[model samples]
Target chain A: MAKVNRSLTGTMGRSWLKDAQFTPLAFLAPTIVLLVAFAFIPMIWGLALAFTDYPILLSPKFIGLDNFRRLKDDPVFWASLRNTFSYIIGTVPPRIILGFVVALLLNQAIRGRNILRAMFYFPVVAPLVSVSLLWQWMFNTHFGVINGILRMLGRAPVPWLTSSKYALPAVMIMSVWKTVGWNMVIFLAGLQGISPSYYEAAEIDGANRWQCVRHITLPLLRPIILLALVISTINSSKVFEQVYIMTGGGPGYSTMTLVQQVYHSAFQSYEMGYASAISLVLFAIVMILSVIQFKYLGARTDE
Target chain B: MLRKFSVALSTMLALMLLISFAAAAAPAELRFLWWESPQRVESIQRLIDEYEKAHPDVSIKLESIPWDEYWQKLPILIAAGRAPDIMFMVSGNVQRYAEMNALLDLREPYVSQEVIDEMYEPHRAMVTYQGKISALPFTLTTVTPFYNKDHAAKAGIEPPMTPENAWTWEEFKLAAAKMKQAAGSPYGVGLGTRDFWLLPFIYQNGGAVLNEARTGSAINSPESEEALAFLQELVTEGIAASPVDQSVGDLFPAGLMPMSFGGHWDMARFETVITDFDYGVTFFPQRKTSGVGLGGDFLAVYSKTPYPKEAAEFVAWLTSAEANGQYIAENYYLSPRQGAKVTYPSRQEEMNLAQKQAELASVRLTADRAIPAWDKFLQVIHSEFQMVMIGDKKPADGLKAIESAINKTLQ
Candidate 1:
């Protein structure tokens, strides 16, 4: 009887090991294949391409550091970088602040609050290309409704997009307008997730609305704000489509973003290698910024 | 085991289905890519039907994309080694692609010597790259003066009929100012901040954007500076509305502006829109020389195309005088074929006006006089001209900057 029991136990143990081994592999196989094919392979190829002089039609020649060397002196690339930073610096804080403020207002007990939330989020769901074209008409220098309103109010018409001085800022304003709804939704989610008991406890302690927000709401919302910041930062850095459809990187490259520069170099100019180098630089910048934000905000969240 | 066997059987069936579908189609498919214009598409489709009747073996597939996405899409298709057999080619981009050997040399198969001679000299030259015919010109347009006859008459100036009779820069400015004064709260000329309108002036003043070899800048020359200064004077002296806060088309047709620089394409729309006022077309005003910029489309075959023989045959037939005239006439375009006649009774005046503009284009599109680095140079010109228009840079400074930028691009 003891010997039979021992054999059965050994068989059970074998079955457990066999089941454990194949289950994880079976589940992970698709994701692993996806990562290898789409992410890992392309990244490796892109990195390899950065060292070559590869124009799509010609045979790629290894020209070490030539593309990088060119980037140092390319005024357009530098200008694009500056414009990108300007877009980021100009776009991020306002998007976050405005988004949070709107989200806070919506958190109030008002009639038709849900409808108001839907109204704010409408632009987010509307197609980008359509909205951009609509904005183009709105921003039209003469016949545009905006200018017409401004004229009626007895103000001089602003060259919202055509002027180099205002082009980047104009694009930023549009960017903020298009995306604040999305960010507001996230902030609202964060705001709602906060326990009502904390506010109640604050009220019991004679805390005013401002003080309650300063002490309880902000600290608890830190992680959510950090998430919003990281997302907006990354997004603003890579701004392309709106600027592309709206300006085509013009009024003298005032609104040319880094991604536009990458696209032009790679496709239009057919300088794929040089474009890859620029792309790598952009990747490094994004990665560094993300890491810093993660460390700073991650530690704060932990505390 | 039975389930696995069933799965294998289904996969085999699917493969067989695909194979049969592929093998069943033996029709001659001629893929044509072009920019979006409903009228143009309808006309081209009619031509295609005619061709199909003539050659039952051929079936034409037309792909239309908007003008903005057309150029961007072509390169991607080329890089993917799946470009359309026949596609639209602009003069500015033809040479660049031809140099890369992306375009199929049409000189040998489709463009015979006799057929080539039958084409207008300017049209033939526009598509010739490195002594090989790279494309066939479909329509030709040149930037010319489009004037509101009422406004011009009010200014006490008759519209210039010939190149010699055209206004000088100074005279043109005075006429514009006089017109503006006559029409209260209206502008004289609509000065757009686009390179197309500005290039004719730049070239007419003997200021080449790039030097003869197309390797360096010539825009910093005294002539270019003079040209830009003249344009600036038009804006600053209130002879023309600053492009900053106006649409030239809206302003021009409303009889708010006397004259605007545009091409033949605008003629059709203008004729319909400007019923209240009479308008006429004339040559762009000359300075040191007569200069006009070439604007039009060309047809080319991709080098990677599998149906080169069929593609060449179709291109040859389409560019024949009869077919060319039919297509151009339907679309209200100026046919590149020498002596090709268009019969659009409703738009007879506009057609005649386009013919006149085409003659001016013939003079400008001559290879000997044409700027070889035209595309690259124009990018710089657009930027520099914008700066000057906006009063951000002095005209001379703008010219200098454009010259530097052009030189850099050429290098």
Candidate 2:
């Protein structure tokens, strides 16, 4: 009887192992294959490339720390860092606040409120390149519609893009215009999710609309706002196409971003290893900023 | 059931992968990259078809990028080790690529010395690097003065023809001023801050963007300063409209500006479009000397190309006098080959007149005289010149800034 029981147990265990081996793999095969082929393989290749002095035509030579060492003195890399930080700082707060305010305004019962919302959201849905080109024409110092209006008003036409002093700010203005609508849509969704009962309760407690928003809506929207802020921060940090299309990193590199610098270094300047080092530095900065934001602002979400 | 599904999916994926691999390895293909107008691209396709017919075993894949993205795209492709076998190049970038040894030398068995001599001296020199030919010269561009004939006639000033008869810088300024005064508009000459238009002024003033060694920026020299000051004077004195941030051709054709500086590449288009007014080409005015930036395209093969011999053969053939002359005549470019005549459309005389003006406007820094640092230094000079034109900085201060910037780049 004991031998029979042991034999049955052994058979059951072998069958269970076979089932376990195939089931999870069957469920996860597609994802595993995709990750290995797309993400893991490319990442390994890029990491290996970073350690080598490689011009595409020549054989790659292992030059371990040399690329990193050169990154220390690359002035363009540092300028790109500063420009990226400025862009993040300039764009994020205004975008978030404007998005929230516009959402709040549209939430009120007004005539053609839906139409207004659509108008506000139109820019976000529009193709970015088209928006950039349109803005470029609008900001043209001479024949552009923006200057045309300014001239009619007897105001001196501002050199919207040509001046180094105004190039970054002008780009930021376009960025804000193009992005505020999308954020507004997200905020609008978050606002709608907030139950009206909370506002009713606040009203019963003798609170004004401002008080209701501060005491109730603010707390409820914290998670959404934090998410928006993080997303916008990442988006603004990687800003490339608008600046490239509008300024081409011109007026003396005032508008050059880290990505543009990397592109130039790796391709135009033929310094791929150094570009990789710069990219690694950018990655580190993005990671650190993400960690800090999560620790401080993201914690409020759980509460 | 799960086992059966897993087995089928894996088998399907494996089969797909095998098919893709087979497709990838099916044929040896030559990738050719170029940038030209859509109409011109069509013309190129016709020639490519002929080439393919003669060499049935070889297949060519053409990738035509827009002009604006061509420079940016080529470098990226090169860095990625996916650059096309044959590609379009320009004088501005020839030095950059040649210095990096990214281009194949064409002076070997493919291109003959006789063929090289047949190319205009400047054109041949532009593609020559370190005593070796690096590319085939396809076209040559010289900065010629374009003026609205109606505006000139109305002002009672006939446009000058020869360099000697060409209006002096002062006379050019006065003529522009008179046009503005008569038109009751603050428009004289249209000056756009593109390097092509600005470099000629520096050349005419006997100012080199870089010193003779091409090691430091010479834009801060007295001659460069005078040139910058003269342009600023044009703006400040209302002899030319404030250099608008638009293409010079766009402004001129719109009848917003009377005189502009441009190249012959746009001549065909201008002739077709400017039916509202008569326009003519004249030699650009001189300061202390006459100079124009050499502008045009070059055809080059990549160093890593698998079929360098065949690629070189195609390049050589394309740049041959017969082929180049046809191309120029078709596309309105000035053929770089010596004595290659192009028959223009119904306006043949006008075309000849424009060609003569271009010859007269030809600057000292032809393809032969260009160095590797030419483009970078020219960019530095252009930025400084733009700053001066906009009254952001004095010409002297701007020149100093430009010199330092160029020196830093060279170092």
Candidate 3:
């Protein structure tokens, strides 16, 4: 009877362990299932579609590498690529710098500091489409607020959105304005996590505010900076809503971006295969940039 | 245990029988799909209600996707062989879906001669892909000039707001210049530099965006070049609104533009926004002849639908004189049905002008321009035209580039 009771208890213990192991998977099943359904399957399907002639209504035909090869001579695609890179180049650095500066400013115990921080972070929470349209009104030549001010200063009106010369610059300005706040918040978190002992030590060593930031704050904030940089770069690369709402990729395609091209090709042109190919390239570019960020500016204990 | 098992089995058997019986009793369902504006939804619901009341045994399901997602979602649905029974087709997209054999032919034994004849000549031509009608138009945009009467009075111009007294091309230019000089407005006229907007100028010059049979672009012809040059001249000389600097939205409603080449459909918005100034509509300015392009929402029955005849009957009823007329009056567009008169309770002049614009336009219109590759054509021309207007490309070079790009797209 004792041996029988012992055997029964052992079996119960083994069953309990099995249930414990399965509980985590049961909890994770929802997320894993969701990711598999929405993300994994779509990624594989898109990559598969890139090699075919899938024009939505028509049956997809396999024509391996033709879509990619066509991209070599495609001027619009090249132009959109150039514009996207230009957008990244134009907007990212300014955002990082402005965010760094603002984050540093907000970190200090200034008067109404919380209010000022909130004010700076407002644009981040605001919808991009609404702000883009607001910017459109401000950039209008004959009637915009900016041009109105320009005229008040006796300067000629600038054709901000309607000309290739100024449309991108205008978009960059809007992007910087819209994005800097989110970067600031991320950076503000990084700044708060930083120890004040380092600053005090630097102060004792006769370091000024600028020097303290240069030697201590910046070095400490490298990981956060890199994080912000990668996130912002990735976000800007996929810019379409703003471009669509503001310019519609017009004024001679000066403001066209890769995602916008993807949207147009997929929906308007119905060349889903080509759109998928362009998207794959965009995905590759983002992946490479992210890898580089992680490789070079990843977290280090010393820093 | 056996008692519980027996109870469950009986329940399962009962459920299956109940489901089968329910299926047998279910009415035939037809799904009607469309991209909706707020007003259009109400109108569609009313029409659906009317149709349902007429046929008690058949149920109509109305589904509306927002405009932005409709294009992407509809294609996926169609590609999966689960297309709506009836789908709303646009001018530029009709040829594409029709070519894919996704739409039923609304011709011969399916539609009567009287119903076909009731469709305006241009609208009739538009829905006929290859030789069979694939869709029936509901309401069409016939291009005409919408002018601010207060600005016209200030400019000391009579400003012919009638089809009989429609401005000639030279007269239109002079009117623009006069409006600028007299009112001190920045731009005399706002000509939307979009491809659809530029169609009137091309039509006015007897040039076309495509060759017949829809093989290649015919926009590089001498007439088209002349049209392009004239447009460039207007921009460079600061008569027409610059494509980049200001839009019709910025110029006209702001009391800065005297005349703009727009369509009757824009009247509703103008009525609301132009409170400071009074406006009137007129026929598009003539060159070789007065010209307008046909653009409209079309109703198409899906080729694979089980209720093809029923869908066709619903569409025919929806676009008929009684329905189309009432629909246009409510929705603010010109009816595509011949002799369909829509009376607006307010803004009757806008309705009257739309009718006149349709008359002037429908006589010499074809949907050949709204080919499968029309989007590509628009992209090419709009970019080149902007470049030309902005002094980046010479007019002839722009036309040549546009021609080359279009040919490539066609290939």
> By TM-score, who's the top model here?
3
| Tens-digit lDDT string for candidate 2 (B255-301) | 76788776666776786787788787777777766676666888898
Q: How many clashing residue pairs are found in candidate 3?
A: 1
The recovered share of true contacts, given per candidate in order, is 0.29, 0.12, 0.73
| lDDT of candidate 3 over B293-344, digit per residue (tens) | 7788899999999978788888888888787677787657877877776787
- Using TM-score as the measure, name the better of candidate 1 and candidate 2: 1
Window of ten residues with lowest summed lDDT in model 3 chain A: A294-303
Report how far off residue A134 is in candidate 1 (Å). Answer: 3.6
lDDT of 1 by residue, B167-233 (tens): 7887778777887776653467776656656766777887766666556777788887888888877
Candidate 3 residues A50-85, lDDT tens each?
A: 999988898889999999998887878999999999
* Candidate 3: Cα lDDT at A80: 96
Predicted complexes: DockQ each:
0.23, 0.14, 0.51
Segments of candidate 1 deviating more than 4 angstroms: A1-40, A140-155, B1-28, B153-157, B181-187, B241-258, B271-278, B362-378
For every candidate in turn, the CA RMSD to the true structure comes to: 7.2, 8.4, 5.8
Ranking by DockQ: 3, 1, 2
lDDT of each: 0.77, 0.76, 0.83
In Å, residue B131's CA in model 3 sits off its true spot by: 1.9
TM-score of 1: 0.87
